[model samples]
Target: MQTIGKIASVGAVAVAAAFSLTACGGDDTAAQPAAAPPAPSSSAAQAAQPEGRECTADDVKTTGNFGQAPTITIPDDCDPPKKLITKDLVAGTGSGAKAGQQLSMNYTLVTWSDKQKLDSSFDRGEPFSLHLGAGEVIPGWDQGLVGIKQGGRRLLIIPPDLGYGQGGNGIKANETLVFVTDAVAVPTDKS
Candidate 1:
């Protein structure tokens, strides 16, 4: 498990400039065992069935499963907060990232609850690269990184299930993950 101060990743060097969105997605011929998928999109994700947290189309459009993760919630107090790593931005034909695609991104990764920034490669000036949807990262990256176009930005609220889960590395245990990323580029074809 990765700890808060443990340099979980290159994003360990990642720092703030927290301003807006950046998106991600997936592809074919995955190289490893797959993880669980995020929630469905559109109105399907949020239902008024329980009749409590009233969801507008905008709220329903988010990728995070706020209802599923106890650590996350849609507060009746403020504007619905941004969802974390909970989007299947693109469809996957396999279980991991494509072998040759490179992702250039700027991001701010923080805790969903208190909004404390944890990692940020963006602070380094040059954006970072990662194989999309690959297990070289936490589950949130693996699951939420799909369906994104190049040069796009999107917010993600990563639930523990898609993150560190029950046993977190150090600072984030039983916690929700939050990320706002900017997808710079994706090769048109790896083959």
Candidate 2:
């Protein structure tokens, strides 16, 4: 990948595989952490100093498939809480979505290992849900998603440690991940 100042474009194989793309952009900068390690996901913070194995196109696995993690690119000047999610979620807001209890989102996912475009509910115009810190999704999403206002846009990078570690997710394994998401709404009580 070619370096655009700090963010690199990554290579084809990397793009072909599940690639993790990080950027120093927008107001999302404050959302990054201080001690960004290589592969070892540090505490949830804005402006991550990334390190570790980059996701290639061959990292994504299906069996252990947990969640689709997409890469986020923040402008050189990003502000935390880039966009928070706060609406009430409903079940089946879209395919693979549970309703009325957690936040719902429409998103696009790519493999950090290869930078491949994996999933995109936004193009499909759908939204998924989350219980917010409920362990429904990956650890990164569970944690990085808090304190965000309703109807927001977020980019996340989850390491294999915080993700599906080593064994790999059919195609994605042994690598950190990246995700781009649109928070449609917060979830309401199921009962």
Candidate 3:
């Protein structure tokens, strides 16, 4: 269990790092997995072309289950937002997430630059739990994921300021980030 916890934490860091680096736009050294997928195409045309508007729930195209790992597809032609934007792809009927509450969730992350998948909690076959608004995760996640209901699925598009900022972990500086998350369980215990 400790090993799994460590891996989850590392995965979270990797997700954060993948959105951080700004100077070296093409370096993959920090994000390389033990068995990495093929290098992403560096062509600017292949990057996410945001459609000059704030992303809404209707803008994201998602498939798969709510509160579990799901496949998210962003339109290539859409323009990225300058600030953090979040939309509920699937609304939940349970109580909404609140600050200081504990939440268990599954998530998938992709870079807005090249749309490369960075990390996935669902792929690991486990969910990660954290305190909402507690700074345990990136600022975008900590802020954007709040108010989500249990069993809800959300899409978050995060700009650099709300992400890792200039001191990125593995991600480039000033990079934009995209995340698809499912709030699987909101435990009653706030401790």
Question: Where in model 3 is the C-alpha error above 4 Å?
Answer: 1-57, 188-191
For residues 39-147, could you state the per-residue lDDT of candidate 2 as single tens digits?
6334433334344443332232221111333343322232222122222221223222232246665555554544466555544444654455544454455655664
Tell me each candidate's TM-score: 0.50, 0.45, 0.69
- Using TM-score, give the best candidate's number: 3
Q: Give me the displacement of residue 20 in model 2, in angstroms.
A: 17
Which residue segments of model 2 deviate by more than 4 Å?
A: 1-101, 167-170, 187-191
Greater-TM-score candidate between 2 and 3: 3
The per-model lDDT (C-alpha) reads 0.42, 0.39, 0.63
- CA-RMSD of model 2: 16.0
Best by lDDT: 3
- The order by descending lDDT is 3, 1, 2
Report the C-alpha displacement of residue 60, candidate 2, in angstroms.
20
lDDT of 1 at 71: 20
| Lowest summed lDDT window (length 10), candidate 1 | 16-25
Query: Candidate 1's error at 149, in angstroms?
Result: 1.2
Of 1 and 3, which scores higher on lDDT?
A: 3
Tens digits of per-residue lDDT for model 3, 1-191: 11223322433555542231111222232333333335566665455344666555566677777856666666665676777889888897667788888787777877666566766777776776777765556667778988888778888888877775543334555667777888878755344
lDDT (10s digit) by residue, model 1, range 1-191: 11221322422222211111112212221122124334546553353124444233234232332111112124332332223434433332322334435566555566544445655545544455666643445546645666555645555665555555433223333555666555656556544
Q: How does model 1 score by TM-score? A: 0.50
